[model samples]
Target: MPSSLMLSFLFFLLSLSACSLKTQTTEPEKISHINKENYMIPGINHGLIQSPINILSNEKHETKNHQITLHFQDEIKAVENLGHTVQLDFSKGSSISSDGINYEFKQMHFHTPSEHLIDGMTFPMEMHIVNYAPPATKNGIPHYLVIAVLFKMGNENEFISEFLTLIPKQSNNTVKLEKGRVKLHDLFHDDLSNEMKNYYHYRGSLTTPPYTETVNWFVLKHIIEASPEQIRAINDIEGDNARHIQTIYGRHID
Candidate 1:
């Protein structure tokens, strides 16, 4: 059966038992990284267009089919060590335009040993730059556009080094940064627009709790280089928090 038909059937069942359905409001004690049955999320175990699936480059050659108009400027957003990974919460209109919708940057976090694979291969680290598009609902969830950049071990990435400048040893802690001190350009190549255009587009969900299936994923083809020590430091803090890869569910990877 097609994934859409499968999802429709699953949700139809969910609706039948909606009154008795119970959702987990707290994190599970022992979550299964592979079998999402342990995730405790409502739609994860059944959501068709789930994320973190391997992108087989040979499956489709559509990197030339799209373009990116990312207008990101350096904003010294508050940097924090969220126990999961280091992150930057964006607010000052750092945005990307697609299909006439401007999805402004929300926050960016990391995964040691990338979640998405390129032709069955994994990178040392992956950065997820999440953005939110307008027409954002007050009650309903808004659409998201996530830009993924994978990092290979090599020379120290001075751009990523900015995050290392202030590492809060403990969780629930944040470090104050001077305005415009943390440059966004350090995160990407000089020719940001060109590199971003050559990317794999797909439909996926959040890699974490609630695992909402409302994201428009764009995994960049170009790989960024970061030093081994940088990668190791990140792992020491986060400790392999990546969820096991989800099934492709017959979804197209364009």
Candidate 2:
């Protein structure tokens, strides 16, 4: 009877050992099966992180490879109405060209009720001067350089008076550039105050859809003054044409 008991105990021990080995071998295969799904591992870089961006200061100023010449055209040849935006096409304008960056003015557009906010304050309106350059000069960068002009409430800006008249009440409408030939040199007067100082520089995406993040923003410290009447005129065209501010993404302020 004792011998029979011993044999039975041995058989039970062998069965238990075999089951443990089987479990160990199959566990790795189960993990391998999950790995084949090509799932992203946890802790990957998701868009959840909102980085804090730094505002640029004068100390961080660097030499701009490209310079722009502002021109005033008395008579516009064509006015294209892009819905929510308007363009004043010019035939000719002078631009400061460089080997690294060469920019030519394509057109000028406007956004009412302002698009950018300084310290959470909105301006009356903003003007965008669009320029284009070849990829070679831009180091294969795919972006259109836009110069933004912010307007605040003040005395009327003489150079901008005629340009504001052509803004259509409706979106996607085109108006002819009436009047005579507008000279570019006359638009930008010799105002020492107009120089861009105390600019906040940062890398940002375009506010428009497709949201290309190739733009380097240089928001001037001083606000340009415009007459209250001009602000009222812009409000007539667009009650709310500006976009919400985008994320700075923890970028360092210069």
Candidate 3:
């Protein structure tokens, strides 16, 4: 039998070895470096502002409903430095999945001076209504859905007048605005044509700093009409609020 000192020495060695192994195992994996040119976009430059793009088509498109409704309450006011983001309690503005899947509307926000360019044209503003699905599906899958709407110049944008009135005129990034219920019908126009129903959809990351790639983008084919005054009103309220567009990264535009 080994002497007591030798036995103690061996035990110490084993314990040291075990500690080394544990340290190696606990080290976190290195984060992969991402190239900004390959993933980021530098949005509109600080140049003299140009007049609104007058591009339009006589083409009409059929419209469909996603069954979303939102009610603004006293508690849904704006927050500071965060722009205007309203959180709907429960599934207030969410879409119901008949496929036995449940989803909830987390919140809604906007991007001024446009984010997504359609056919090489940028709109005055864009809004994103974010939704999160329930737990994993039967196939062990979970997903998020984001509906994006582009606002342009036109007189038919009266639907947004009430909402716009809540925007604060100060240069502060965030502010508290009155809460009101905004129904799905309030945002969507029913006079769209069949041709306008087609949209450009693809996997994309959020258009903000620390841009996350967890959004399922559904961009409408037809741009919603907003008066030039409406566009200026929002811009005046939230100057340079939009983030730069990110690279498509060979990502398929479905």
Number of the predicted model whose TM-score against the real structure is largest: 1
Q: Which candidate do you rate higher for lDDT, 1 or 3? A: 1
Model 3 residue 30 CA deviation (Å) reads 21
- Give the higher-TM-score candidate: 2 or 3: 2
Quantify how close model 3 is to the true structure by its C-alpha RMSD in Å.
15.2
| TM-score, one value per model | 0.78, 0.60, 0.55
- For model 3, the stretches where C-alpha displacement exceeds 4 angstroms are 1-81, 84-93, 96-102, 134-143, 168-181, 191-197
Residue 119 CA error for candidate 1 (Å)? Answer: 1.3
lDDT for model 2 comes to 0.56
Candidate 1 lDDT, 1-254, residue by residue in tens: 99999999999898867744433221111122322444444843545557788998987644435446777665766888899887877757677878666788888888998999888898889999888875567786677889899999999998778878587888879887777667767767466676676788887788887676667888988899999999999888877977778877445667
How accurate locally, in lDDT, is each candidate?
0.76, 0.56, 0.51
Model 1 lDDT on a 0 to 1 scale: 0.76
By TM-score, how accurate is candidate 1? Answer: 0.78
For 101-196, candidate 2 gives per-residue lDDT tens digits of 556666766677677666567777877665566566545645455556678888887766766776666777777765563433344464322443
**Model 1, residue 181: C-alpha shift (Å):** 2.2
